[model samples]
Target chain A: MAENQKLCPMFEFAFELLGKRWTGLIIRVLLDGPKRFKEISAMIPGMSDKMLTERFKELEAAGILTRNIYPETPVRIEYELTDKGRALKPAMDKVQDWAETWLTPPDQNNGE
Target chain B: MAENQKLCPMFEFAFELLGKRWTGLIIRVLLDGPKRFKEISAMIPGMSDKMLTERFKELEAAGILTRNIYPETPVRIEYELTDKGRALKPAMDKVQDWAETWLTPPDQNNGE
Candidate 1:
């Protein structure tokens, strides 16, 4: 395809990847550094293991993240952002800034 | 709340809005100018009326897009980006840029 083709499908695909329930949170957690599966799981409190695995695979396939396995005694596995994934920071930041401006607090908005 | 309260929830919320199946396409369609509902719908060929309605209401509630009603003979309704919605351009651009980089052409990739 040409370089400057219309980006509707691309935007749709990215939205699809980012739109998964815990996908954004997973990327946010990974922003700090490479993380073990357990570490990432711990950071996102309510996500189930099944969902995490699914999102990880989707992200990996999309080339947004990379997974590495070390030849340690116990076999350590870690996930980190690829350059593509890191490039998402600015976009994610814009969303974060908008959310801060518009959304009510969880407690107050939800009356928790 | 503070300007930056970690932002995970906000990111999640924005992702939720952007992630809806037709939501990103809707935003992309709207990029040109304010569009009437039918105009928007025409741009996205496959979407059903009910889904478009749901996404439009959701985007409005999220403070991203605005709806205007004119009391003409036919009662025209139009949708346009709010300042908040306009702010999303950069983020959306990044996703589009990434999609162009990663995704194969629909015809080739899907073997259509």
Candidate 2:
């Protein structure tokens, strides 16, 4: 049987990464451009510092984000999307479009 | 500032659902067509029944999947994608395409 006969392993792996909580949001936040750790954290309210740090590390390891460290006395770190990461913008935009069309508020569905 | 000045809430909600474990796979499996519970279970090896059941229920609630039950003596249940769910195929295909291009196997990166 052809390898594509079944579920594509690579697709599954990508989904595995994107499916994680905060991962997609992190990517969305970074879409604007590179941002410092604190800046990204501020955009995602209620996100714990530990979780953000862990997710950033994971994204960096996955090659989705590039982390730059300044050589100054007080080190400055910023995260930016790699080429591969930027390619995901199309998929993310599609999801956003689908959500707006299909997902309505609960109150809108019923008389409240 | 315009409403689009910041992250869209609808996009966040869709990502929240898609980012869950097994949810994407479930959609992938159903892409072919409606399948019986056992059929889907067989296709996705290693998936626990409890987990599948839970995911299916959640998908139905999310309006992504429609469950059909027969009125025969022994009931038969099949799951099919709703219009919204089928609409996600484009996004899913993009993800699969991206995976093939960017997600090279670790072994391929170095001469092992």
Candidate 3:
């Protein structure tokens, strides 16, 4: 919105992607490496297949990640971050840092 | 969710706040300094008073910002970031930098 005119319009862009449900979590999964559609979805407990596909497509359109269609009888697709996507890691890192430092999230599953 | 058990639960916490509509914008306004309720809402074009109030309460509860009630002719209230709030700047900085470098936002109102 006004961000385009303001100092950090990119924050708006970044948020447009990350702000959606399962988007950041998808990226977080890829931070370790590339994964197929199912691999990414499995890591996030409650994400729907429809929602996961939406996030993947959005991230792909943004040039943050790419999809590879394997040349096989049954083509397989894997998603991986591009250089730009990898570059986004810093922001996520800082958010993680900020959270650990200042936040105490309520425990739900509290998986360990 | 899995964040609490895996790693970087704070990212989840940070996202829980920032991902909500108008939440990041509220924090962004406070970054400059404290502001009255009306002042913050004016900066964000279409933010409802209800939404702003909700975001303010959330951030205050998170300890990222604080509220002050000055006993003037009538009580004057302001919201300002705490040291913890200031600490969250780097994460936002990184996101802004990533956005500027890698993203091109569509312009609407284009306010400068």
Candidate closest to the true structure, highest DockQ: 1
DockQ of each: 0.42, 0.39, 0.39
lDDT of 2: 0.79
- Models, CA RMSD each: 4.8, 4.2, 4.7
Model 3: DockQ score: 0.39
Which residue segments of model 3 deviate by more than 4 Å? A1-10, A41-51, A106-112, B1-10, B41-51, B106-112
In the range B2-70, model 2's lDDT, one tens digit per residue, is 233233556666766776667778898899999999999887776798999999989999889999998
Model 2 Cα shift for residue A106 (angstroms): 2.5
Docking class of 2: acceptable
TM-score of chain B of each: 0.85, 0.86, 0.82
Model 1 lDDT tens row, A1-112: 1232355656667777786777878887888899999988887777789899999999999889999999998999999999889878777776676666666565665544
The candidate 3 chain A region of ten consecutive residues with least summed lDDT is: A1-10
Write one digit per residue (lDDT tens) for candidate 3, span B38-58: 888788877789888888888
Give the candidates in order of TM-score, highest first: 1, 2, 3
Candidate 2 ranges beyond 4 A from true positions:
A1-9, A107-112, B1-13, B45-51, B107-112
lDDT of 3 at A81: 95
Ranking of all predicted structures according to lDDT, beginning with the best and ending with the worst: 2, 1, 3
Give the Cα lDDT of each candidate. Answer: 0.77, 0.79, 0.76
Backbone clashes in model 1, listed as residue pairs:
none
